[model samples]
Target: MKRSIATLFILFSITIVKAQEIDSLSFIKSKRMSDDDLAKKREGTFFTGIPDFSSDPVTGFGFGLRTNTYWNGNRDNPLFPYTPYLAKLKANAAYYTSNARELVLSLDVPYYKGTRWRFKIDFKAQQNPANLYFGLTESTLGQLRLPSDENTTFSTYREFDRARKTLRPGGVGEADFVTDALSNRFRETEYMLNLKADYALGNGKWRIMGGYEIQHLSYTTFEGMEAEAIDPITGQNTTAPNGISLLRRDFEDGLISGVDGGWVSIIQTALIFDTRDFEPDPTKGYYFEIANEYSSKYIGSQFDFNKLFIQGRAYQKLPIGKRTVLAGRFGAGNIFGNNAPFFEFQDQWSPEGSINALGGRQSLRGYRANRFLARSMWFTNVELRVRLAETQIGKQRFAFAVAPFFDAGTVRDRWQDLNFKNIKTSYGGGLRIAWNQSTILSFDYGHSKEDRLFYFGIGQAF
Candidate 1:
């Protein structure tokens, strides 16, 4: 662990390159263009320079800086802790050129013209840790995205619960009802800082990309996350009364169990390869990517967790005598060493108790939230998309279209210790639009067999 952290630190301090020039993006001028016509125009470039670097879409490589601000909602509110406003920025440059050498080396993205190899130095800073993309512990993890509910297991719930308990308020033992809720707490403020780099091999048809990720996070949960009520140094439980507390409805049902102190460290190495010469295009927008990610804390496992993920994403444009497109992705995670939190229900008077639990956004969407859960959990997600309007309606900024999508995944508890076969699934879809190819508007309708959900956001599904 010490060696890994040292390597990352050395890599981060080693390079500073220039930014590459980026060409403009082009698209079909009409909603009526035939599929073949759209495919023929693939020669247009997003990279006008050797190594691509643009602050716009955040594509190429170079020495750049990025800042992300995530403003969640007020913590004193109710069930939901965040309102969701986010913006990310970066400054970077890169260069790439080919020589008649035995091995290829260029900082350019291998798929485009004049593009070679590309490398970048990136510094990310945020006063609020919750704004970070990933963290080691549950609380530090911030606005986490779990696998689909249909795929989650009881163990997943338990691991989640364990993490939540670290942040409970009201000192130690709170109300049964409130303790249960606090055990599944959410928080608002967090600050973070990160430094990393990206390296890509440009071969036109095949390319390999990988990099290092390091971050420091300070976060807070809606529920307090400390075990003792008083400060060990000052002799006081500094977080109480003002934070979320685990209170009882009557004292039989569990409310919250514990609160946590949100601080963690994460360091990872990533590697990915793209085949079939994938390029982003409106007409021939087809590509497939398969990647494996392994993450661990550079420091010891103070939070107790480790993760291994095998996932894949694919995109394709359909040609059924129409200029339509379809894109989707599927992913699953097998976690070990990490303790997910759940609930430990107490019966009327039986010392301690455990019945069963289920239901959350990660899976079982049709069921009420936290409806059922157990020991271990597994989850998966898949999305289907369509392109409605790609060409200009009248003015360049008037382009728009509609699409219906479907999403499904599940979670589980413990089924012979097999996470793959235990969870369930749900499906749904939505609509999208683009203005001058710069700004995109999206609305999606996601549903399970028994529940329907709507999501509003920006950009393409990819």
Candidate 2:
């Protein structure tokens, strides 16, 4: 039996309950930007689009190219009186085709010197669709972010964001200087390969998703694994649990840790779904997803984590008004394992970091980046979208949409901690300009008792 754990899927199952009802423009955006990018849209969240991988399935030939830029510099920081621009560029495109025998080729190119590029192909047979489905997803990934004399930060994970969240004034701003290379830079550049397969059981309307991916994680970053661990209990942190304090965690965004060395291995079976049985409208429907995926760092990678997750989404047309629609829902999940991986965020309200509001595009709309990364958490949202304008764009009609929504949720606590009797809530509205049958540009602002924020994104929050 594979030694892999079931943490990922386990949490997936529990959260399986939550859902999304993606509509028109936003629907397409969610698919393109993907769960990963949507999540990154949140402040303080890790820029996991690092490898720029697409979680959606692929079976045909198509090429896509995207370039992303990140410019961040504070005017108040004394590190360098002059605010400098921190720029990042990422672009990717892929093509794929298949033969009856299950053969495919995929080429991915990413130019940003801070990420990775990949090419993938697969071959297998659908011997028995009745009870077994076997296939392969093989991939080769190369480095895009190579180290340069001017570039020094090794790991750009949330850990760095939290550490840099606050600036302490000493005799000179030089106090926050990077004297050690490993602790300051993300410098590894390497290649990797991954293989995967899946099988599922049907339970009437619901078909559980379970599969595995074998991965080879061999890359370098400016930082090392021994850096520091964000205190889940007290946002305050120490570099070495017993020796030194590395960088302080930032509660506004979220916190993340860094790792070094490389390991490759097979992840255990997880879950997935084919919501066709639940809804028919490809643009607006009701369905859910759950997973308990698990994998090791590298083949011989040091620490391993097991994770569990579950989520659900649904939508329908309402008679409230013209071009008016109602869609949205709630989601909850948990993580458990010897060393389960988690999204970290220094909670300003809590100080210490425990898995709480892993804020992302999917969870909290007004927050900036991983406003609150959490290991154990709950996320919820309710939206009513309406299309006001109708015009043709190219081969498709364009639409202007407005959605009034209420979002309420919390993290780290069990259901009991959340009082259905009384909950923390936020209200907001947004506008969207849609093109063709596929794209959208949205601006949503939400306000709550804690904070009020604005969100400008490519697609829908569903």
RMSD of 2: 19.2
Candidate 1: which stretches are off by over 4 Å? 1-115, 119-183, 193-202, 218-263, 275-305, 338-384, 390-398, 412-422
lDDT of 1 by residue, 47-109 (tens): 111222211101112222211222212333221111111111223233212100111111222
lDDT of 2 by residue, 382-435 (tens): 888887877754433456788888876555433334335334456788787654
Off by over 4 Å in 2: 1-205, 211-284, 297-301, 341-357, 413-424
Q: Give the Cα-based TM-score of candidate 2 against the true structure.
A: 0.48
Clash count for each candidate, listed in order shown: 109, 83
- The best candidate by lDDT is 2
In angstroms, the error of model 1 at 29 is 23
TM-scores, all candidates, are 0.48, 0.48
